[model samples]
Target: MAEESRKIIHVDMDAFYASVEQLDNPELKGKPLAVGGGGARGVVAAASYEARKFGVHSAMSGQLARKKCPELIFVSPRFNRYREISHSIREIFFEYTDLVEPLSLDEAYLDVSQNKTGMPSATLLAREIRQRILKTTGLTASAGISVNKFLAKIASDVNKPNGQKTIPPEEVHDFLMQLEVRKFFGVGKVTAEKMYRLGIFTGADLHSKDEDFLTTHFGNSGAHYYKVVRGIHNSPVQPSRIPKSIGAERTFRENLSSEIFMLEKLEGIAEELEKRLGSKDRAGKTITLKIKYSDFQLQTRSHTGGHFVSKKAEILAIARELLYQQPLRESVRLLGISLSNLNTEQDSSAPAAEDVSVQLRFDF
Candidate 1:
């Protein structure tokens, strides 16, 4: 099928977890709140805007959050409630377009180029959707409208906390030229520092480099930087959710019964996990080790902490403890290591600024 212009919109709810708590309980509104525990070992899952003013944020230790905001209130996470609301929000997206790719419970990408309502203006569509979300859920959402996913995602951050931004078709070039490299979608702290060393401080600086130069310094990710700076992202919004966990598992044909042998296999599994995490520069505090016995009985052990770890050595050290935490009921047939609680829950990698030629105009 021949395609015309593309209109991608990224909608992100405002402090989804904390907001939901506030909606259900009127007392939590307009106060510094963290949706986790207030105990010394508690890890924060989310924070409200009031809490953000005091430097409290998600994934931080609850002890630190309390230190940052003395009056901050902490509540246990209600994941089932969150999932329920997230389902309702997705229903709203399906009403607009079928190309709904959920990044998490709080955000999604909508391809509205050919929408159900036949709206010609992506900007207006975003506004309408945000309004609908606010009316139905009693919560606010921010949206970004652009010709592709990359620009759309970044644009959404420009005006946040119940606001929206649009990068019109003709304005894409200038926007990229003026953007800071640090704000580019995939550029994390480590990548940004490396780019700075190469004297690439902004989109204009990144656009000046050739693919070869970037590839040499950054490996495969450099090619991504080169294309993104030139408004050339071509990845589409797939209709699925961002992965909840990333893992590597191995099945042994011989059903090893020895713990020593399991340790050897775990080292190799950890190596694969490091590669997966490094690919996206993601770090997480939660690690789970899955054990499948010869009899097909499955068991899982998990540990979560305040700091994030992405190295093989760090991951293997934890996996080793979980393996010896108890006696194996039977010979193990499969062993796996998975990491969750990632820092990049809201991060997405692709969305083209337009067709490669930039000839397609996003209709209004």
Candidate 2:
């Protein structure tokens, strides 16, 4: 089975955006820098290692970051330049194997089980790829080598900033058992909090729970929790891991009772979805609308057999329709729109751009 024989390597760029800016401009090197427009409303896009030392990080409010590090140097993100470097790294990965699954502009999963170079060891290949990225892009990358995607991704993060780690097949269970539940891929802040309240703080705690019990508590994702706790993921390293859906949701600072305001927020989300679909050369047959109400209750509505929707107007129209079909039972805090049943061929035909798209589907 390709799943069982999989040789996955997770490659992560070190401080991707910030590193690129520093590389191109010597003045920014060895300084605390963040990539984003700096203002009261602006947030950090990428933080240099120096800035990280000051506890600054991406998605942190720009105003808050300024308060944390008063001397922080702010630079607007050069996405075009970052994309250029991302492209270069993508080419380098393909040179080793075409089974490349990019997670983001700065990270990717490469399945080199059967590589172009006929390399028998994926670890050696990961080392070579890291070196090549440094030479060509003037940037450092970290890598993790394992038999599966889950272990490989965790290994990559274990050694930070220009390092590599490997977890052998025999050590998978032990490695996972020692990990904190919060560090698990699928465990977000909300989920982690729930797990904490349940007295499950580590992978070991999760492993102790029966599969049926977890499923009863966490729903479908609980089954995933059971497998990941034992390092038993069976998902493949898909070569064309294209976006099957595009959607955005916001957790409200305060829950809204107005249906009109919720619809207005959905409009913004629809526009964002439209732009994303237009930017990527793919069409979808399904439009899914998700709403999370104030009580944390979640529900999704989807429409199928839709047109080859590439334009925002069409996508929004469908999403709006699906959204209205359901009643808001409680005050809503989050809304999202997604297009699924993808057309991969459309994406492959697009002009190749760099910066791997890293999609962290923690739900598996």
Candidate 3:
């Protein structure tokens, strides 16, 4: 089974949030548009290609984005409408195979080794799915077809914003050897810097290292890197698709040096997060606060309490306290508030008082 060829496809919506805004407001099409909560403290949700040309991008502060692109238009995110479109896309996928693993509202991975449609070629299946998405939802999606998730994900971006690419088995080696190390999964800013310092700037450089040497430097993650460098990734496609939590955050245009500014940002994030939780009819026992410094250093603190917290005030209070407790040398450039340890079973559906007090443990 491990040696057999696998049929994997990665589908990603093009400029998802910004595109949705343009779709609903036809006049905004082909213009620079940014989807974000509008406030001095709000963060960008997405930036259109015209906006990108001006250096505007997601996670950027609205103020900075405006400075970069003075004509950048801001539109608020409409998640319900986005969700409606997402559901339609999911329905299209189910027509081909149930082995669809959604990464988010805008991206998914499908395993079509043995598809419901009895298709012999995964590339053909990818094209059909892309066409169906466009016919049904007035939107464009890019797809990548390969033998595994890693290759498929990279191939998908080769020709983006409404394009498809395929990497057959014969071309896998040449494709991987020339691939940049930064494009490898799990290699973010910090990891990429470390790889560069070690003279492993590309996949070819990484492949030249002894596996044991990589393990010594990076532990378990190094093993992942080593295998990927050799074009060997066997992770399974997971499709159960239940979200464990939901949250939102923002990055400041300039470093936030004052508590007043930070708290204000936290309040807006908490409000948005609570709205999402309320819509899902979910509550969480754990609240987490994430901070990222200007240097890209990141830290997080989480608290698990007895009460299920769904109120904005409660979340903000906890986040503020966490922010205060952190020892800082540099000003914070980004702030994130999240809730986990979720209890999604309906409160009414739960057991009696004694049962309500019972704690469930997951061994995984």
Candidate 4:
């Protein structure tokens, strides 16, 4: 299949966790709300649009969120309910195309170049998918339609929270050229600042740099930047996504200065991690311990053994070893445990070779 002929759509649920909370309880619908892992020390997992109006958002500390939106309501996360809803959403995606690559519980990329419904236009498919998802889940979704994933993903955010955007093949070049560098998917705060320092503030500026100069500054990702700026991202939509690691973490109500308190928290985190591994029927040789200090400084220590550990005792033991391996830099507020290099990591079986022929004239 030619790159220009591909039709990709990125479907993103609007404020998914907060929306679910709003759906389950009528009182939270119109109020400023933050769905959190827990209250007090926990970070905002998701913020309702009402909360966002006051500059509240996910990963904002609860303390700050409260200051920003004094009337904000904090609710505990319900993973089981979120997963049940996510499964239903995935079912909706599979109804249209098998080439769905889920980025998380709330967003996914789909290749409907050859759709199950024989729909010639990808824009209509996106509208119908969003409509179906709303009818089925009572939740709204936004979509982006384009020739490839990169354009589609960015487009999804342009008109958000129940809106959709399309960037057809012909307009992709100009669309990318005028785009701000900060709007690029992987360009976070640090990267955006660096790009600013380098005078690469827009796609046009990025396209002005050679691959060598980009590689010199951005390492391996420079090559990727060089490709995406010209609307040249060609990575296929991988349906068989693999988990790189599995982990669980918890935030404490107060920062603990004692290692004993840290160890006690590790036990519970390990127990949650053990259940997660069991659910996936997975175990790995690598165990990592993550720490967040009172000042929000984050650190991680990892150890990989020859043997894999799936049980609670073994996981807790390794986590304990990692905890003691380094002295506390500061009073800690968060702890986590994770496993990687799983048994599921094996030689890649090739994705099915296929062909696609779609109408190149997409109406964005």
lDDT of 3 at 213: 88
Off by over 4 Å in 3: 37-39, 242-288, 292-298, 302-325, 329-364
lDDT minimum window of 10 residues, candidate 2 = 355-364
Query: Given candidate 2, what's the lDDT at residue 349?
Result: 62
Error of 2 at 21 (Å): 0.4
Evaluate model 4: give its lDDT: 0.90
Each model's C-alpha lDDT?
A: 0.89, 0.82, 0.84, 0.90
Sort order, lDDT high to low: 4, 1, 3, 2
By lDDT, the best candidate is 4
Please say which candidate is ahead in TM-score: 1 or 2: 2
Model 1 per-residue lDDT tens digits across residues 104-169 = 899999999899999899999999999999999999999999877899999998888999999887
Cα lDDT of model 2 by residue, 1-364, tens digit: 1223567899999999999989999999999999985774466989999999999999776788898999999999988998999999999999998889888899999988788998787778889999999999889999998877888999999898899998877677788888999888789999999999999999999999999989998998998898778776766677777676766666566678887787788778878877777778767888888887765578999988745685767877787788779677988767888888777645556864332211121111
Quote each prediction's TM-score.
0.72, 0.78, 0.77, 0.86
Q: What lDDT tens digits, residue by residue, belong to model 3 across residues 171-204?
A: 7777878988999988998889988999988888
> Candidate 4 has which clashing residue pairs, if any?
none
Q: What are the per-residue Cα lDDT tens digits for candidate 4 across 114-223?
A: 99999898999999999999999999999999988888999999899999999987788789889999887678889999999999999999999999999999998897
Output the TM-score of candidate 2.
0.78
> How should the candidates be ordered by TM-score, best one leading?
4, 2, 3, 1
